[model samples]
Target: MATGAESGRRLRVGLLGTGGVASKYAALYGEYPRSLLVALHDPFDPGAGELAARFGGRVAASVEDLIASDIDAVVISTPNPLHLAQASAALKAGRHVLLQKPMTVTLAQAEELERVAEDSGKVLALYMNSLDNPVFRDLRRMITEGVLGKVGSINCKLANGMGHVWRNRPANFWRGSRAAVGGGSFAMLACHYLNLAQWLLDQPIIRTTAIGTNLMCDHIEGDDLMSAIVEFAGGELGVIEAAWCVKGEQMSLHGSAGSFAYIDNSVVTMKADSPFIGEAIRYETPGTRVVLDGLLAPAMSDWTNPYNQHRCFVDAMLDGTPVPMPAGKGVQDMRVLDAAYRSSAGAVHVAVHVAIHVADDGAVAEAVA
Candidate 1:
């Protein structure tokens, strides 16, 4: 691990896979004072040694070797399919894990990972990194506090534009492949919206119907664009639109009595409506964003892109506290996505079982959506 002078204490990290996702974890985790990317397992590019040189750690020859290393945690940043395998290995090896999103494309795989984590009693966290944004944190808090009313409906739209799906590639480039990604835009991008949806409404998706297709990305096999309507346990409806359409990027949300708009890809909201209409709520960036915007964040700007989720997982494992966003929830979200796809294909409504609803009056109403 990376030791700093006499402190001699750093949270050891064994990172598996060296892809865009893993790189993000590497960069974000490096910012922590107590964290070090000590060991790595990337047969394609063993930057662990070089990373160790940069951050003060060692490069392991394989995931198994890394597991054997005295690391505090593991960041499974491998491809979509490898998540379960790698995470299962790390959990059995007695390491906390920060698994990348889509958790797994299939419910079965997700359940297996969940079962392992539960059996081992280790921390298994999912990096739905965007939720780490301070804005999202505040957003959820407001909804929980009833700052937003009944939340009768929610509309979410994300535009990929011409940018690469993973970096200079098309949206859902890898995710478009079912064998690889499990679902189309619904699984990859809409999952974020769905996650936020459940959080915002504090309810589960009661029923859903969706339609998707690979419209723009001619080469992609899955849906580049997907439109879905989800009814939560409270009969609250949510509309989602995702695609690699727009040339740049965009995202926004409309709620029962308020709305949120983001511009220029910043997590900071350019505009947010109050539960009472035109009333405005200033943007409060999410926790992950606050740490990510670098030193400039204290100046009152939005901070984003840090792997605070992983940091939280690290803390949870070390401290034995149960924080939200566990790997099991990631698995649940995949099941929801699977439900939506099934609904879309069958041209019928699929029901969801987990639901939590906080009324506009601050009362908690829970049910199976």
Candidate 2:
């Protein structure tokens, strides 16, 4: 495969949407050696020009204008509803895409996007900020290595004060529309941890039961406080609680032989048997602290440090490396979110209808069971 690097040229990039999440990723195009931000488009945000000024791109007149320009790829950070149309357009135009979280508002849209991506033969990577975390990598390693014997359950709580932000105002913003975001806290926030839990366990969540309500944020259309208990296909259980009305985070991974607990993904505490560790061990970042006989601590990663997720996307496009987070994985994520929403609506346990399958050629396929 011929690459931009091999041709002694950087891959020209385009950006859609200029919101907070877009800003978080836009800088990498200018910083990474193999990519350059050449065009940008955001109809609702006047700040698009400012983003282009800082990130070395020209703010295009429209999405069509941006995609029609001389760009090889696009980074889409728009609202949930916009995801399908924008991503579909880009893929049809033969441009690689890096899309924001909660891939789409509906499972149908996700499945459609997946089909388009597979047919287009272009890279469609999901931009998940949590995937950059080194902690989860270490945790996955420990679990896979049987350091934590027979993992049984994973409990997570992710909350924030977005309810307060929406309380004083009317339902004016895009986030205030359930038609746009799919759900409230669970869709916007809990989806991240849900994907993470399944990734760590290397299995699909077969069933979920959830309860959610618009407790304090009546201005928002969906749930402000939501909790769900998920059953993995491997029989491991997961407890998830997400709150837009509160502000805090906690995650615990329990195993028959040990357990790991942490808050805000920092200052983790680990407890194991005599062979693994004598007692509880707690520590923070910077240095590589040893846990057992060579297991290092989950040190913090500066995701903006030139070689982050965005760079990985560039490499995948130009160098034919594996996509960091594939579009099929995003479809599975949508299935989990869909199950949670269905379970909450029915007040009963709902089964995730989609299952993941790997092809003989190593491509991922969706099996609707």
- lDDT, candidate 1, 53-129, per-residue tens: 65555778777888999887888877688888888888988888888777986888999889999998788887766
Give lDDT tens digits, candidate 2, residues 183-221: 888999998888889888999889998889888887788
CA RMSD of each candidate after superposition: 11.9, 12.5
Q: Give the number of the best model, judged by TM-score.
A: 2
Q: What is the lDDT of candidate 1?
A: 0.66
Question: What TM-score would every model get versus the actual structure?
Answer: 0.76, 0.84
Worst 10 residues of 1 by lDDT: 294-303
- For candidate 2, the 10 contiguous residues with the lowest summed lDDT are 292-301
Model 1 spans > 4 angstroms off: 1-9, 46-49, 162-176, 245-256, 267-307, 348-369
Which candidate ranks first by lDDT, i.e. highest?
2
